[model samples]
Target: MNAQFDIRSDSTQISFEASDNAQLSRLLDEIARNEALPAPAPENVFVGDGDYRAIGLEYLGHFVHIGGLKPTHRVLDIGCGIGRMAVPLTQFLDPKTGTYEGVDPVNEGIEWCVQNIASAHPNFRFCRLDVAHELYNPGGTMAGDQVALPFAGNSFDFIAMVSVATHLPAKEITAYAREVMRLLAPGGRLFLTAFLVDAEDLSRPTARPRFIKGEEDGTWIADPAAPLGAIGFDNGVVQDILKRSGLDIQRVSFGHWRGIGSTHYQDIIIAVKPE
Candidate 1:
């Protein structure tokens, strides 16, 4: 391969165009081969292989349909555990103009993505943040609220954080919202999934209160014994945080976590930076 075509070795950091049928065929074949391979061990990945594929495809479709993800978009996947979303996106995003960058706290998931997804798809990359979460990374040094991501300001066109916010405390959620706003290119969109709780929703007789109130009124925790087991926040407070961060809410779709019989299990929020 010539200098212009040399993207396989450090493909995790590079992007290339599949300008011809042969190149396109090769790309498709690589994706198919990867899809056939078994996912990382379930214990390490936190989700079953079959479930990963199903949820990944579902999230990808939602990103396309609801978030307006385009072939040319530069995407950032927060909490990209074990390449769940990255697997399906390999076939959707165009190699020439599209890119995927995934960041996660767990080393196992990041390692798997770097070895498999990033190696095969040059336009896709993964990074491990080593962020400290009592449940996920007990030994981590960095805190999600304080750590800055490796990306430049105003860079990504689309950002997705599926189930990520559900695991973050209120302060971390605010910090991430601010960081995401800073990293979003003008007009860029963000898609996030969480267990949203409004005042009325919380008051409902059927409400099970997955997360009990933490020290902060805005924060909630699933396990009082383990504060980081699962986290949630007041939906109104989160919405206010995003608005304060300069992101306009484009859509809000509640999910079945509230027993409302929605398409997904978590509520989805789509926010966009102003053009």
Candidate 2:
């Protein structure tokens, strides 16, 4: 019963059970053992508030610094849950030259990260802010709401938001886009993912409902089609919002889970601040 993370860059977020690959499973188990990560926590069935969010976050973190992180760069992990990106990031960071910050709306997520991992490390910081890549906890924050960031502008060098925009509505996406601009440092990079498409090709819709009516504010929420959250992105509208926020789109890539099919492909976006 080890808690480890086994992730390779080429691997996508596809279902592991379906593959039935013994070697991959053993690889994952080995990685888990090294990290002391608990046994596979039934990520396929994300239930309740503490679904396998941590698992996804961990995997995303694995991808964030996939190739490698520079020695002096700082990292901001938005929607950072548990110690997914937060914990693994420590390995890549230089400790003195590098800094790490994580934000999460769920207090428990932030609390767990801070207590179990961040607090003990002086160079590392964590807050309960929910803002993504925004200037909330410039010194390693982990709290932010739908709107409003507490950090000064251009506070981070590198920020990664793993599947944060996947569950947001248009307005929410707009908010995240604006915040991303404010939080990124000049020449900084922001890596994130979305479940929706911005380009209206008549093939893709803005949203396909996924929640029971009145689930929260009687709002028609996106159907929880995916295990983690909602899916789909607005048609380039998010990129436009970033323009107004003074941010520019650097690159966009489409990714598909192993067996999830085209409908669930993630829109990988990399936005950069003006150098």
Candidate 3:
């Protein structure tokens, strides 16, 4: 399915849009034909870690069962690395009604997704955001706070940021929270994961990936030299940010990162914009 799509950009943001319905039909047919293909080997995984296809499948269930994702919802995938979540979603979302927009700072991931995932699913589009991070995009020209995402206000019915906040500082998290609130439609849901620590957890001696640095601003880093490498925020700070962003916190499921038997490695937060 060689569908043509438009890539648009302005000073602050860049976007991809699919304009061909016939291309979508062909893509869906191709997907149906290859539904039984085996998952990729772990050695071939590049963007993050673990088996790429398995991780994507795992998160797809999380999105549907925990985040209330619908087949027809318009989704905004923040930090969509190499189409991990998008790949599994193609099987679930309705081609005619559901749409996906992914944004990430990593150029390679975005480029790979455009070539691999977007070509197979026209409704799935990817964009690169040139935002700076200590680990991911050091050469990025813009700070996370300064970025104005290209999408219109209240555009997406669901917004996801899996494993994203764990790498961002307090200021960037706040900025992204506001952006999520702005981009989400009224009553839309926001699903994200982060490393969360409470005062009691901090005092414990056996805390996993002990965050011993930068507790002044409710943000802690496992490594002081590389603050963005692995970060944990105080639970209260996360609550405050979402509340200030005008999102109502619905649930926060603590993950196994702190040595508890949870469903994931990072805390899952579900919030909804008020109607």
Candidate 4:
């Protein structure tokens, strides 16, 4: 099944066209001067260990140069923890046109973003879902696959799920892909990051997390006792899921996590919904 799809091993430097380069530069300058931008979330409230400001800036560049994000495009950010991605966009997205909607299972992060980020930028909104996750929200009422995201169909121009898939089981991943397909407007783009592994990558000694256990459904995990702690899917499994969800695979940039020389830490998959 994977042989049918063209997944590129991209190792090129991150560069934007002249116009985009200029736009990114302008946005960066604005972000630097904007003293009103919310301060970084406190250590306890921040979800991930990565430097909050640096990762946000880095991925903001990726959204522009790789995801083709425009100032006027509506964006949906899944697993938006403590507004790491939203803080940078407050300077770039047009107040009248571009709007951002972020949803996550962790209540603390969502609350922080609502009070700090959304209070200042009215167009930016955050919602906490009661979705259950073994590592993040174990006592929630809803299963990850069962939650119907609160949004209209074909609503967003750009959707991103950074570091979200790496923590989900296979079924939830499929459910989220289907929802992403439904939420994205026709011709809209999906920028997703995941820990994708092929058989050869599994044999490499330097592959981060080093998935040692295999599930019956072909998903791989770093720890069998805590499957959702760090999950990986076979390259084919991800391709099949996206294809089944009616998304056209545009590109796949392998990440440095697997000892590969790439720009990102997790593999990036860019796809589009056909018009």
Question: Which is the leading candidate under lDDT?
Answer: 4
Candidate 3 residue lDDT tens string, 67-87: 887667899999987787888
Better of 1 and 4 by lDDT: 4
Model 4 CA lDDT for position 51: 70
What's the lDDT for residue 173 in model 1? Answer: 80
Off by over 4 Å in 3: 1-47, 202-207
Give lDDT: candidate 3, residue 108: 80
Clashes of 1: 0
Query: In order, what lDDT does every prediction score?
Result: 0.76, 0.54, 0.77, 0.81
Error of 3 at 132 (Å): 1.2
User: In model 3, what are the clashing residue pairs, if there are any?
Assistant: none
lDDT of 1 by residue, 1-275 (tens): 41123222223322334343354345444544454544666666674235666677677667866787766789999889889888878776877778999998888888899998888788999999888887778799888789678889999999998878777777788888998999999999999987777656655655544556777777777678866656677777777778988999999988776656677777889999999
Pick by TM-score: 2 or 4, better one: 4
Q: Write model 4 residue lDDT over 181-232, tens digit each, in one string.
A: 9999999999998888888897778888888756756778888898877789
Backbone clashes, each candidate? 0, 33, 0, 0
User: lDDT value for candidate 1?
Assistant: 0.76
Worst 10 residues of 2 by lDDT: 9-18
lDDT of 2 at 165: 68
Tens-digit lDDT string for candidate 2 (1-275): 32223232123222222123463444444444454432223442221233343454445333433412343567777777566565544443555666777766656666666776665566667777644432223343432236755677888888877767655555666776677778878888877776434323223333233223324331332443432255454446556656776777877665442122342245566778898
| For model 1, the run of ten residues with the poorest summed lDDT | 2-11
TM-score to native of every candidate shown = 0.82, 0.63, 0.82, 0.88
In model 1, the runs with Cα more than 4 Å from the true position are 1-38, 47-50, 199-209
